[model samples]
Target: MTDNIDIDRSLGFTIAARNARGRLVRLGPVLESIISAHAYPPAIEKLLAEALVLTALLGATLKDDSGQMTLQAQTEGGPIDLLVCDYRGGELRGYIKFDAERLAEMPVNPTLFALFGKGYLAITFDQVATGERYQGIVPLEGATLADAAESYFAQSEQIPSLIRIGVTRDEHGCVAGGLMLQHLAEGEEGRDRIHTRLDHPEWEHVAILGSTIKIEELAQRDLPLETIVWRLFNEETEVRLLGGASLTKGCRCDVVHIRDVLSKFPAEERANMADDTGKIGVDCAFCSRIFAIPVAELENAGETTK
Candidate 1:
């Protein structure tokens, strides 16, 4: 983990001249930990990796420290039925549910449409402090997950945006990196409402520069994110680097929590849940860990809660 200190972090930057802001995210061991939890196929592993990167990039934008951002892609008649990933603070977790037979029929490398025929990408933000929640949905009709995100901003938020994600795996493990750029011109109060003008010259100029980023540059572990940002916008007048946050593989599955949840069920139901050993096994899909709770303890669970 010490070697991955430089990786698994998200950095924020702003282009003053272009009136735009962007984020760079790179995942190494953190990504490997998440993918390794399950024996996912190559295609699923790659897709999950990309989703995690997208989650990190978007989740880092939360203003509240306790806020959470969740991204879900749901399909009806495709190989993958559901893809869910969420981020809170700097921690991220995600999983995929798919039909094995459908996935097996896919090619070595399946396209987004092939994996999820007619799906929708939904991004949700939950603010813990304010108890406020917001959601945006867009059709998943692009070649890449980044394209779906771009559509979300274009149709839902009406912000001219560009996103790129890259994932690569080898003998070692999987690593992913992503970039997000948005045009938010500075206004007297704060950011201006430039979404109405999608053809704005400033946004176009920045988008053109952002599109030059290659998959190799984004996924390369040796290439520093700062260098990538510099190479893209160095010619501009000012590129302000903001504070960054470290990310981790976040799967919050606690024995106590699981026990408490089980306690909510009637005593008869709890009894029925336990096996011959008198323990109920609870499995966490995120981390793929199982926790066994003794039924005897749960008998008094409701009393203790009161």
Candidate 2:
């Protein structure tokens, strides 16, 4: 099964930045491996994997304890309504809500934004084992999801950042790959250096090289990091790899959590749920698992402690 594939060697990136150290980041062997279990449509899977990689890339930026990080995009005029994912400990779980039928007829150009008209993007950070949370919402200003995310960084952090994302499949038709690039925070001096580097003809050469990276080879788990680096940035001076983070597919679902949701119903509503059969159906949206919650069992269970 594809789930058995080791993502440790599978999902990763090799970075090359002038005047900056580069590193290989691996999101464990199981992150994408688990995500691949779901049989998502081609376009949806590509988008999902791109978002999944962002979680890993941004997760590496978290300075606090390992916690839950979520990315969401909502659009009104799009073929799709929203795309969201929650990441923690290198595992991610989420889905996209869209009209699959509508998208099949949609043109590939102008891409996702053409479908979603007006909406907002939001990111939330929740501390693991702690109730603390922080969320920021930004208007969907850019034509791309990555553009929306970059806007969030500028508005919330007041730091100039850029993110580039590419998602595509291989000839073999396996869910292939994605890439992210961001400008590190720096003062005026650092910014000057960055501008000089960007102006260099050689840097443009590297940009072309970076663009040529194939999505198929990126999915190969057995390939060495150096091989990827060389393929993308061969003969480029001062190439280096800084570091990387690993990821997997995970969901925050549990029996207790489901019960808690049921408890949100008033006592009267809970009573209304009672049928002669004494069973109420509770389904998980992500996994589509149905739990036949028993009224009698719930009554005996008492109030759930938050």
Measured against the true structure, the TM-scores of the candidates, in listed sequence, are 0.94, 0.70
Question: What are the candidates' C-alpha RMSDs?
Answer: 2.0, 5.2
Per-residue error (Å), model 2, residue 79 = 3.3
As for candidate 1, its clashing pairs are none
Q: Can you write out model 1's per-residue Cα lDDT over 149-265, one digit (the tens) per residue?
A: 999988887678999998997566788899999987456245446433643578788999999999888888877889999999989999999977999988999988898899989
Q: List the global CA lDDT of all models.
A: 0.90, 0.59
Per-residue C-alpha lDDT of model 2 across residues 1-306, encoded as one tens digit per residue: 344233442233333344222233333334445445566666676676666666655665555547878888888877778888777776667677788788878765546566566888888888766778889899878766767776886677544444444444443243333444433323435354335444443434444555576655556544555676777667665555544444545665688777767777776788888677887787655554677888766766665433
Q: Pick the candidate with the highest TM-score.
A: 1
Q: Which stretches in model 1 have alpha-carbon errors above 4 Å?
A: 1-5, 188-199, 300-306
Which regions of candidate 2 fall more than 4 Å away from where they truly are?
1-40, 104-110, 127-144, 147-174, 185-209, 233-244, 260-267, 274-276, 303-306
Relative to the true structure, candidate 1 reaches a TM of 0.94
